[model samples]
Target: MKIVVAGGTGFLGRHISRALLDAGHDVTVLGRSPDKVSAIPQLRGATATKGDVTDPGTLSGRLEGAEAVVQAVQFPNHPIELPRKNLTYDRYDRQGTINLLSEAERSGVGRFVYISGAGADAASEKTWYRAKGLAERALIGSGIDHAIVRPSWAYGPEDRALNRFVQIARFSPVLPQPGAAPQRIQPVYVGDVARSVARVFERAAWNDVYEVGSREVMTMNEVVHTLLDVMGKKRAVLPIPSGLLKMATAPLKALPTPPMTPQGIEFATQDGLVDITKMVQVLGVEPLSLREGLTRYIER
Candidate 1:
């Protein structure tokens, strides 16, 4: 099978691209900067193409002869940097996906795999979730064989979420948390996410939505403490009220490169747990535990 992966230069996208290549399929990575594709070691075996999902014109004829298309493009800043560089979830996630789907349908692509988040819902107030929900709806209604994989919080060596926590723990004696509420999350390993995505190409996975996550569910405080423990550091966790934390970080939003944002704080405090039975059974993958996955990077 010939597969085209949008945003294949990104952390998760590269992993999925590599997995498809390992399965003996031809893979093409589509991104804004095609030249930088060679810089990523994981994308070594796959070819790269210059295409941007935001601009539908750039994606013309990119899907030709491709049997499947994986919608993996996302705004790198995400909830942390809203409207950064004039990029938002609406423009990137929702509209970008619609553009890709339009091209895929025109090019006779049979399978469409979308990487959605755990809390995706059209009616959700959260910006990211709403955008993803709208994209998933578009893919389902596109008259294409589609599989939507809604992954919980994913983490790895190159991950921004856990790696940021580890970086902060190395320098600070105090770790600030959003609230006392046990914001639970099942952190899935990036490798498992890649394998699940690869499995979507199989005939059994078509027209289905799978929620991927590990077996362990940890609270927000537990996630931070675990990172501190893995890094061989001890930090006092201060759970401040969500509103106060947002207000405190409000001024940083004005900086050219703000370290944090209110939307990011809200995402951190929300519960992101998911049921992984479908991911395990259908994808035939057993995800690594939180400790096992974290230790792989932090201990290095």
Candidate 2:
């Protein structure tokens, strides 16, 4: 099978490309930066094409002659100063997804896999979730054979998700956790996610959405503490009022991708557990536990 993974230079995308290659499928990664794609050894054997999904014209030729298409793109370094209301979630998450779907359909791709986050809501007030929801809807409506895989709190070496917290813990003597720090999350290993995508292809899963996550449902504090324990550092965790933390990070909104946007804070405080039954049933592969995954990169 010839597969094209959009945004394949990204943290998750890179791993997914490798998994596809390992499965003996011809893989091609289409992304905004072809240079970054060249850096990955797995992708070196696979094709790398430079294109932007937001601008369909640039990606027209890139999607041609592909059996399957996977959209793994995200707008990471966009302006954080832009309020959620004014953010380009529609432009990037929603429209960009639609653009990819249209191209895939035009190219007669057999399967379209959309990588979305858990808890995405089409009717939500939150821009991020709403945009993802919109993208999900667009894929469902595109009449292209599609599957949506929603992952919860993915982490690995190149992960930007929990690395933000790790960076804070490295610098500060105290780590500020939101609320009671008991908000639970099922952190899925990136390798598991990559393998799941490959398995989905191998099994020919079509028109189904599955959530990928690990076995352990750990609290926010436990996650931080585990990282600290792995790093062999003792950092006192202080539970700051959500309001206070939001206020403190508000000034830093002028930068691209603020560490603590209100929406991000909301996402962080909530339980991010997912129903892994479907993923297990369809993919037929066991996902790695959080502790097992953290050990790979967690330095002593």
TM-score of each: 0.94, 0.91
Candidate 2 steric clashes: 0
lDDT of each: 0.86, 0.82
Count of clashes, each model: 0, 0
Candidate 2: misplaced stretches above 4 Å? 78-87, 168-172, 178-181, 254-260
Q: Give stretches of model 1 more than 4 Å off.
A: 255-257
Q: What clash pairs does model 1 have? A: none
Model 2: residue 193 alpha-carbon error in angstroms: 0.9
Number of the predicted model whose lDDT against the real structure is largest: 1
Distance from true location, Cα of 17 in model 1, Å: 0.9
lDDT of 1 by residue, 217-249 (tens): 898788888777777788898878888888988
